[model samples]
Target: MNIFKYINEAWESLLSNKMRTILTMLGIIIGVASVISMLALGEGASDSITNSIESMGTNTIYVFRDSSVTNSKTLTLSDT
Candidate 1:
C-alpha cells in the first residue's frame, strides 16, 4: 500500500468520528498540560528550597545544647 493512501485513509477515519477525535485530542492536551504543570511545580519547590539553604549561608552550623550537660560556659555569638 502507498504511504499517501494510508495517510488519506487514516485522515478520513478520524474525520468520520468527529466526537472521538475531539475527545482523543482533548485527553492528549490535558495529559501534556498536567505533566508540564507538575514539572513546573516541582522545579519551583526545588528552587525555593535551594534558595532557602543558600540564604542561610554554607558555613552556618546549628548547635543544640542538651539539658543533661550543664556547663558553666554558655554558648555565645562570638563562639560561632
Candidate 2:
C-alpha cells in the first residue's frame, strides 16, 4: 500500500474513535497551554530581574550557594 493510503486508513481509524481522539487532543492542548504559560511567566520574570540588576550597578556580583554552605557562612543582611 502507498503512504497516502496508509495515512488515510489510520485517519479513518482515529475518526472512528471520536471520544479517544478528543481526549488525546484535550491532553495535548492542556500540555501546550501549560508550557506556553510557564515560558511566558519565566521570560517576564527574567526580564524584570535583568532590569533590576542593571539598574543596581554593573559591579554587582550575584552568587548563590547551597543551603548548607549558606548556613555555615553565617549569612546575614550585612553580607549584602
Candidate 3:
C-alpha cells in the first residue's frame, strides 16, 4: 500500500538485472528515434511537393493526349 515500498522494489529489480534494463532502454530509444525520423521525412517530402505546386502558380495547365480515345484532339497554341 506504500508508494515508497513499490518504488524501492522496482529500483532494486532494475539494479539486479542491469543488462536487461539497459537493453530495454536501448530498444525504447531506438524505436522512438525511428518513429521521429520517419515522421520528419514524411513532413519534409510533403513540404517539398507543396512548394513545387505553389511555385508553378495557380494558373498552370497540364495537357495530355489520350491514346485510348480516338476523338481526343491535340492542343494548339491558338487554344490558349
Model 1's TM-score against the true structure: 0.76
Question: Could you say which candidate leads in TM-score?
Answer: 3
Global lDDT of model 2: 0.90
For model 3, state the Cα shift of residue 65 in Å: 6.6
Question: Per-residue alpha-carbon lDDT of model 1 for 1-80, expressed as tens digits?
Answer: 99999999999999999999999999999999999999999999999999999999989987777778767568787986
- How do the residues 1-80 of candidate 2 rate in per-residue lDDT, one tens digit apiece? 89999999999999999999999999999999999999999999999999987898978866677765534665588886
Greater-lDDT candidate between 1 and 3: 3
Q: Per-residue lDDT of 1-80 in model 3, one digit per residue for the tens?
A: 79999999999999999999999999999999999999999999999999999999889987777788988776789987
Residue pairs in clash, model 2: none
- Per-candidate TM equals 0.76, 0.66, 0.79
Q: Which prediction has the highest lDDT against the true structure? A: 3
Residue 5 deviation, candidate 2, in Å?
1.3
* Order of quality (lDDT): 3, 1, 2
The residue pairs found clashing in candidate 1 are none
lDDT of each: 0.94, 0.90, 0.94
Specify the poorest-scoring 10-residue window by lDDT in model 2: 66-75
